[model samples]
Target: MTITYEETRELAQRTVVDARYPNINIYTLDAIWVLYDRVLRVDPQRIDDPARDRFLLSKGHGPSAFYAVLAAKGFFPAEWLDTVADLESPLGSHPDATLVPGAEISSGSLGHGLPLGVGVALGQRATGHRDAQVYVLVGDAELDEGSNHEAIAYAGAVGLANLNVIVADNDSASHGWAGGIASRFAVNGWSTATEDMHDHDALYRAFTAPHPDRPHVTVATVRT
Candidate 1:
């Protein structure tokens, strides 16, 4: 049975640990939900399949939405959601790939996910997993890291067609990019799309759009 979006939201709400970060995961809810629900080609039953698509959450400071979608999609039991951030729970404020079933990377530090994603995509191509795709979700502010800039430039230069990046833009960047976020990736030779994060159809189209010889980026603008 496919889980409804409302059910996923309720599952996310079940993970109430820190009062200080009450709404931390809200901004990413829709974007993650759409990926798990419609775009990603990962199977909960065969997580270790080499051909499976990879989704890395770079903005892992608040992963309630990620956890909820994983549980809803059967990556883990829903009961685990209730114990998020607990001392013994595998689920934490920042996702750990070693602990979480569907998590591809142990990410919490900003600006690391995109670079790691580039490596993963390169590995997949080298390993002959030509059809596999690598997707990385990053916060707008996280792009301020110099590592991501290098990754972006390298991915474009090498024409990593299987690599995709989703930037959750809530207008939170410390040093905003000129001509908007899409322009940053566009200038680096990447295919770019800007869409309202809340628009599921638009997001799906952006995620699946063809980028023949280069990596693609979708800047998902959301309400701050």
Candidate 2:
């Protein structure tokens, strides 16, 4: 079954677990689907393969999209989505790696995904696994977390070419950067690309670009 963005987005809408925040962030989901479908090199059937790509959701608060993509990609059954946030369900508002079939790490609190992704990328390299890549998704607001800065700087310094970060820029951050988010990663020796998250072709090109001796960051902007 081929999955289009709209189809997966509809599945995401069905996974809404909270009533207080009722709207699904379709912008974020659209960006993620493009990256996952076009750039990620992981097999849903061989999810546990040591050489498989890793995808982590740093902006875990808005995870309906991730869950939908995972299920649509066959990481788990689509039926599980309906039980989200139920006491007996593993599909909680925030994903749990141990419980959820495709989650690489359990995340909800901000600022952890990039650091963990760096570690995973480094480990994959250190273990002689050359083909694997690590992709971490973060919110624009998550840049305020000092830990992300450290991870960005460190990943750049070490030249983790296999590590990639996607920052969903919705202008939600409390504080702003002068040169924009891509500059932060660029100055730290990472390759940076900025594009509209809804532009699938541009996103695919950015995600698949060559970043020799450095990490890669794609600043995907959405409407404010």
Candidate 3:
């Protein structure tokens, strides 16, 4: 069945609202759209096109929005989204790059995406694809891992101007409100921004602008 972007977006919102139990650490559907619609860029059929920007859903559980976006973009039949995470499904709860056309990395583990994104940016530079930007959408709670810091520091030191680290802060991470995450990124030389993650226009601007000589990081402080 064909699904419009609106339907895809709505289902994604409903899935997160209904799928998880009342008490769980998983991200909400609202948060999914907040980041996915705002930060990532893609063209499903031509995902591998050299001009297409790379998007890594580091907050892997937010597959609702990711799948919805891909479906709407015609990466696959829209009906396939209904089977996401099913035993027979190719669309897992977290994306599998080898399986998903638009995904840059396979991730369920936190703290892995940013480093991978950094690597992608480095690869882009080395390959003379300097215009391609790698964007990683990480969960604020995932920062519990020391590796997130390592990735941020390395991005700063390496000066990956074409890479973007987007932290989806949905006011639910770490006992409500992930603390000092923006400051952490700032200290590491990443230009940071905090705003309602659902604000699409603001996030679009943030995601598109390249840092002059350093990695660009935007921590979207969402209140979903």
**Model 2 agreement with the true structure over 1-224: per-residue lDDT tens digits:** 88888889899988776656877665688777986788788888887889888889988886899999988888888999888888999988788899988789999999999999988998999888877888899999999999999999999998899999999999889777777999999999999999998888999999889887889999999976
lDDT of 1 at 141: 89
**Model 3 clash pairs?**
none
lDDT of 2: 0.88
- TM-score of candidate 2 versus the correct structure, residues matched by position: 0.96
Candidates ranked by lDDT, best first? 1, 2, 3
TM-score of each: 0.96, 0.96, 0.83
lDDT per residue, candidate 3, 1-224, as tens digits? 65554686675654432245423333333334444555445666667776667877777765777776666656777667666666777787678889876677898887888878878888888888887778787887887677888888888887778888778776546654335678887877888776566566676677667587888777776553
Give the clashing residue pairs of candidate 1, or none. Answer: none
Regions of candidate 3 where Cα sits further than 4 Å from its true position: 1-5, 14-41, 175-179
Query: Residue 155: error of model 3 in Å?
Result: 0.8
Candidates in order have lDDT scores of 0.90, 0.88, 0.70
Clash counts for the predictions, in order:
0, 0, 0
Against the true structure, candidate 1 reaches a TM-score of: 0.96
